[model samples]
Target: MASFLGDHELVKTLLSSGALPNIQNYEGNSPVFASANFSNNKILKLLLDNGGDPNLLLTQEYVYNSPLMIAAINENIEGVRLLLEAGADCNYRNQLGNSARKIGEASLNLELKALLMACDNPT
Candidate 1:
């Protein structure tokens, strides 16, 4: 997958070729999800700009797989920023009832936790 590889050009080519931005892999992970998990902010933005859902949830068994969740759990600041700016729900909880903020706090990423909180209640 281009997202996993951080191949911006390949992703652009695929999208131009009509590949669905929201297409999921066998694990139910979309390109946006892959980009976020890998901290590929450029690719994530590409997908989002092409109609990818920042808040799209994967139907996996126990994984909380939204873009914001993935980015926060991975301590990916840029990915988190992009998703938040794209209107991702910072308060959205997954199957474990863990929001991005909770995950960041659990991981001891205080900056990420603070960022999520700020994005959740921007003024």
Candidate 2:
């Protein structure tokens, strides 16, 4: 809930106490994945730095949204960048066969599309 609330201090406190950053609730929404939809990247960064898996999926029925997808769909560019830098799978598609790259393209976010493209052709 700290992540959803964007409470950075509380999130850090919990992580410091050995809370699993990847632990998802019954909704299949982990702190890491849920943070992607937030307006800020602070919680996402903290979680990622504390061993949160950027590629963790929201396992809701007929849905599979990775942190990258959540970020992309919500237009959280920084969150998307953080997830990408953390080695998120750009090719991963949800149940609807939608990918972050596709979301970027569909949403007309050039920078997002560029980022995904860059990952596809790393130096």
What range of 10 consecutive residues in model 2 has the weakest lDDT sum? 114-123
What lDDT is obtained when candidate 1 is compared to the true structure?
0.84
Model 2: per-residue lDDT, tens digit, 79-117? 888998888988888889888877877877788777776
Cand. 2 Cα-lDDT? 0.85
Q: For model 2, how many clashes?
A: 0
Q: Give each model a TM-score.
A: 0.88, 0.92
Query: Which residue pairs clash in candidate 1?
Result: none
Clashing pairs counted in every model: 0, 0
How would you encode candidate 1's per-residue C-alpha lDDT over 21-123 as one tens digit per residue?
9888777888888899888888999999998889887766756568898888789999998888888988787777788877766767778877977765433
* Error of model 1, residue 8, in angstroms: 0.9
Q: Which candidate is the best by lDDT?
A: 2
Q: Per-residue error at 90 for model 2, in Å?
A: 0.8
Off by over 4 Å in 2: 121-123
Best by TM-score: 2
RMSD of 1: 2.3
